[model samples]
Target: MQRLDATDNAKALVRQLAETHGDLMFYQAGGCCEGTQPQCFEKGGFFPRTNDVCIGTVEGYEFWVDKDLFEYWKHAHFTLDVTDGFGAGGFSLETPLGKTFQVHYRVFAEEELEKLPPVKRNIP
Candidate 1:
């Protein structure tokens, strides 16, 4: 496993979220319109992906991202900020690498994640 350095701002941001919201899982998935797929996850159980990497933990919550995906984003500079209008869920990260990548955080209900298709892969 590779070691990832979450900026002090990033660590603090994640810790705050976990403390407010019970447990948070980190993973990568398709992005919203005009957004680079980000390392995201809802609050629930998740199957491991081939390239997934568990970088470290924050406030007892595991933080991870697909190794390959993380490498792709390693060079993208990010900024963390907080906002109001959401229930302890306004944390967001902005990348200087343009809108190609989109990172988002939201309160996810357990039932909502059950509807996602199971992860599958085929190697030639």
Candidate 2:
């Protein structure tokens, strides 16, 4: 499994979100401008693909991604740094292909989190 460096700010934000929402799912998806981007989903969203890597937990919350996707991006050698705040948003990962993937994390109200569907792998 690949390793991820969660900034102190990112950790704090994740902790706050998990405590308030129950859980968080981090996703890696194909992007229009770049190869891929990092997205954080509240509890009740889709899960990771079987080929993804599980990077352990952040702030007591579990996190993982599709193994094939992870490997593709891993070969690109990306780094992530998050910035937390009401309007400051999260961080971005710089992929080995010289593309940048952005991450946005927001506080999801209980009702909002409840409305989201469970996370699952997108097999294509």
Candidate 3:
């Protein structure tokens, strides 16, 4: 089982972004003002620090969650989605388009949990 997935709208947006920006990545925000919104950027734009957990990829772009935040959300399955309007921080690439990347979550089933793939982290 996967820790994360994406909605059709989100996948399409990624494709649109890739055509213009080349490559992309996502970092889930966890601090003040940013709340828990997912911030999208051109690949390598925002580097992942040690301890950041890479839940998985959304449309092939890595999706990382702050380690502290991941501890709180580890039990849930995250579904990346897009919506109209600006998210907490305007730093994400989508903000300029009047759209925001968000996550929909649900606790994983017992069987699914056992089969979930391991998450990657910046160990060094």
TM-score of each: 0.40, 0.52, 0.96
Writing each residue's lDDT as its tens digit, candidate 1 over 1-124 gives 2233344555565665556555666544333542334332345656556655554444445555565655565433223222222221222222221212224333334564454332223122
Task: Give stretches of model 2 more than 4 Å off.
Answer: 33-35, 75-80, 84-124
Greater TM-score among 1 and 2 belongs to 2
Off by over 4 Å in 1: 30-42, 45-47, 67-124
Between candidates 2 and 3, name the one with more favorable lDDT.
3
lDDT of each: 0.42, 0.49, 0.91
lDDT of 2 by residue, 64-122 (tens): 65566654544332334353222211332212223333443334455554554443344
Per-residue lDDT of model 3, residues 42-119, tens digit only: 999999888999999977889999999999999999999999997798999888889998999999999998999889
Alpha-carbon lDDT of model 3: 0.91
* TM-score ranking from best candidate downward: 3, 2, 1
Q: Which sections of candidate 3 miss by over 4 Å? A: none
Error of 2 at 97 (Å): 30
